[model samples]
Target: MKEERELQDVLVQLSSLAPGPADAPKPAGQALAVIKRQVKQEKRAGCQPWQRFWQNPNRRWATAVLSLLILFTVAFSFPAVRAAASDFLGLFRVQKFAAISVSSEQLALLERVAEEGVSPGELTIVNAPGALIPVNSLAAAARETGLEQVLSPAALGEPDEIDVVEGGDGRLIIDAAGARRIIELAGADPTLFPEKLDGKRVEVVIFSGVQQSWDDGTVLLQTTMPLVEYPGNLDPVPLGEAMLQMLGMNRNEAARLARTIDWTSTLLLPIPRNVATFNEITINGSSGLALASLDGQYGAVMWQQNDVLYLLTGSGDTVELQRIANSVR
Candidate 1:
């Protein structure tokens, strides 16, 4: 009887305070204390009447809603919680998403490379016109190696001109225009690329091409279109060379083992499997991979030849692209 009387007293006070505006001043401390004490007593003693009321699903749901309301009230009352909530809600903000949103697997691959301390290979930083070494001016030594191999495909037409950039000892600097061209070659947004590429250096090989006229051997159907090529595996080092150099093996034995070793699979690009579509292509009888965009456009093409990896990307038709691929001599 005493507990019932106390509960009734607490309910009367709550009812009096509940009739005000939602944002009205909070209830008196004494009233809140009485309600808290009554609820604690009922919960600890498992009051038979209160337990029966909660047994009904509707009443249980109402209790849950009331609890949530109280929690939200307390949460908003704190400045920190309000700020966190505002920030948390900002993820739904409207904006353009960019292609720089790389997959987790790609990030993991980069981490693995960093951890393994693998060299990222040669880097090129394109400078102004005066700093660039014209392709025709390339030393015979550089041309003999993978550095000067002409990746310009025949279908794209003859390149107007080419440059051999030593990149100031392998560190290449690319300007904003070059960066924009690279992003387009990747079929990515220009915004996703580095904002300040003027003199910003990177480790990737960049063969930048600009077409002046279609008759001048520009591969792209559109004239004056910016075309960029990032070729990999242009030079293949024989494992036999390593054995002969490292283990001091005889030339004949190393040559025999190197001939037996297969180097075709070495030029692999680790594309993610969850992409929209992946199709197998044959480039000169060698297997290649083609990834298509969600709207059925050819997003990218990768193939290996002479132990070199060639990746071509743009907003081009697939059939025309295959013809262009054949021209990459």
Candidate 2:
């Protein structure tokens, strides 16, 4: 009886998937073809399993298996349909847990700097754990796309050594040993860093300051460009509707939810409140953000120029930071 009830419930869900009568848009060519095929297959009668499993008269078990198989096939094949499903089901979502697009430890550093707020002349060890990547040499890294070759602050004169690193589509990471080596060479203590950076592969350029102590004297610059163009209203609405139709979703509901999403013009970056002062400033005649540590002794100034984001961070005066930022050509 329990099993029968479960099977009935599934049937009910499946039945409810059909789109209702409405002014809903029609599916695209490919999607319409698939949907029509699915309907035709459902109407056919035979237990040819591979050829037409849904037509099997075997009842509950075969029906359930075939239905699941169809759902998986459609979901995997169509992205619009997948998006509609995710939106309707609310199964997965992206969440923001911290700021700076770096590690939790790097978030802590930003927050601490924000709290200190401008203690001039105090050379503090402003750590950017995840943001830093080690490279064999900048010359080697210059060969890759989406990376900068020339970047250095005139305020710091000459760096002891420079490093370059890249990240892939997913957040790239380095082991603790590599992180330690990076920090150590950059004149920072390896012990002060976390085990991993789990950060995206934006281009990072590190300029080690003339400090024997790793606690102070480091300048880091990071740049990132969008990997993929913003997905505008290009998703075929009918395809989404068709997908929902497969799941027994009503046409009206599917049509309304399957429409393409228009993301906002500006991407939001959530920086921790305690990290520094958030001030909007003009960079090369464009809007930008300048973050100065609580002590005002260290800071990061950032701006998006030509779709590429530029971040200059160090324990230096804001004037110098801006100058370095302006110098990035």
- Report the number of clashing residue pairs per model: 10, 24
What TM-score does prediction 2 earn? 0.36
Distance from true position, residue 16, model 2, in Å?
87
Per-residue lDDT tens digits for candidate 2, residues 148-218, read 44444444554554444333221112233433443333223334433332221212122221110012444
Minimal lDDT window, size 10, model 2: 90-99
What range of 10 consecutive residues in model 1 has the weakest lDDT sum?
91-100
The alpha-carbon deviation from the true structure for residue 170 of candidate 2, after best TM-score superposition, in angstroms, is 3.9
Q: What is candidate 2's CA lDDT for residue 103?
A: 36
lDDT of 2 at 299: 65
Question: Model 1: which residue pairs collide?
Answer: 124-172, 125-172, 125-173, 126-173, 153-327, 154-327, 156-218, 156-219, 157-217, 158-217
lDDT of 1 by residue, 58-117 (tens): 333322322221221111212322111111111111111111123445434433423442
Q: What is the lDDT of residue 328 in candidate 2?
A: 54
